[model samples]
Target: MENLTLEMSKNTNTLQEQQLKLIEGNFTKSEALKIINNVVNVKINFHKLQRLSKIEGNVNDKCTYDNSRISELIDDQADMKSFLRSLEVNGKNIKISSTINITVEE
Candidate 1:
């Protein structure tokens, strides 16, 4: 169970790194939100699996610590998702206004 948690954390971290890359690029708002949603779902699934492992009495203190880490990850994911969604909406508005200005200038 500890191993599983560690693997999950690693995967989550990788996904976060990918999200950072996406932010660095010119990704659409919907694309960014999709990535964030994937991260949140992964974290939630990991948490559920960890809880089940604990209930089955197959997890140790290490697993408990990892579960705490997973909880933190989930919280971070939720915050990031909200922020990304806000950015997406704001960006779309800006783009629309810019396009309108260009059309007016033409």
Candidate 2:
């Protein structure tokens, strides 16, 4: 059992060792807003399309999850917009960092 555990520990598991730095950049306030807003809008649009597809495909299936997500993203956008607005300096740079971690669920 000890040897088996040691072998397993030595093995390289790609699925468990997955991490990607998706976005890392510094930009002006307007540039940061544009980049962040574009990403959020894409997510919202994706959910909207999914909800529409579900509605058209099934009569009884309601897109509660997608609707909730869309609403949440919209609220996040509003909050971020307000926060970005507070940075009045056009020359000041905002740093954006995003990381993605992938895991397998049982």
Candidate 3:
């Protein structure tokens, strides 16, 4: 019911665990992407990589331990502000930059 997917590849063993470790080791997104590509030759974006690492790296685990908690994620006001600031002020949002081109392929 959760629509989960199981992507099988040759070197897919314990990949998320290694990715979580790389994230814990404070490697940047580009660094992680390059390492993954160099090791296994996968061309995944940083956003997808972040999804596998967000919980351990950036998220607080206090909400899950609470029984009567309203939210499962760390979505407090300060967290939201910090998230927005990272997206806007950090200047790493490549999607909004002017180098993107939209051309139809026929």
Candidate 4:
């Protein structure tokens, strides 16, 4: 079992090394397979495609993790409103100090 796992890791690395050689752009499955085949001398099948999809997922996770703005926007509020005061103070109707954070940007 250990040997099998190790061999799979090795295969994954080899596939990844070839995957890195792809041109920067989208391509059909056949085109992608061709590119990898040109650089890799191993078997290719749906397994590689599935593994590459996992690699793409990891890359996407990294992209989202690196984006601080997206996390901050999650707790986003459309508008903030303070409690209204209509009573009098010091013999005259007065509106106390108030603040509203309508929008946040960092």
On lDDT, the leading prediction is 2
Q: Could you give candidate 1's per-residue lDDT for residues 1-106 as a string of tens digits?
A: 1111111122343333321111223345666666556756876887788677666755544544456676777778878778876673655521111011111121
- TM-score for each predicted model, relative to the true structure: 0.42, 0.72, 0.18, 0.18
**RMSD to native, candidate 2:** 10.9
After TM-score superposition, what is the CA distance of residue 61 in candidate 2 from its true location, in Å? 7.0
lDDT by residue (1-106, candidate 4, tens digit) is: 1111111112343333321111344333333334334423232333355455655846545422233333333222111111112222334322222122222234
lDDT of 3 by residue, 1-106 (tens): 1111223333255433221111123233344333333433222233344445545654654423322222312234345345444543242422211121233345
- How well does candidate 3 match the true structure in TM-score terms? 0.18
lDDT, residue 11, candidate 1? 32
User: Lowest lDDT 10-mer window, candidate 2?
Assistant: 1-10
Q: Over all chains combined, what TM-score does candidate 1 have?
A: 0.42
The lDDT per prediction is 0.50, 0.72, 0.33, 0.31
lDDT of 2 by residue, 1-106 (tens): 1111111121256645456665676777877788779989999998888778767967787546536788999999999989998886757678887766666676
Off by over 4 Å in 2: 1-13, 57-66
Model 2 alpha-carbon miss at residue 73, Å: 0.6
lDDT of 4: 0.31
Per-candidate count of clashing residue pairs (backbone under 3 Å): 0, 0, 0, 0
In model 1, what is the error at residue 61, expressed in angstroms? 14
Q: For residue 83, what is the lDDT in candidate 1? A: 81
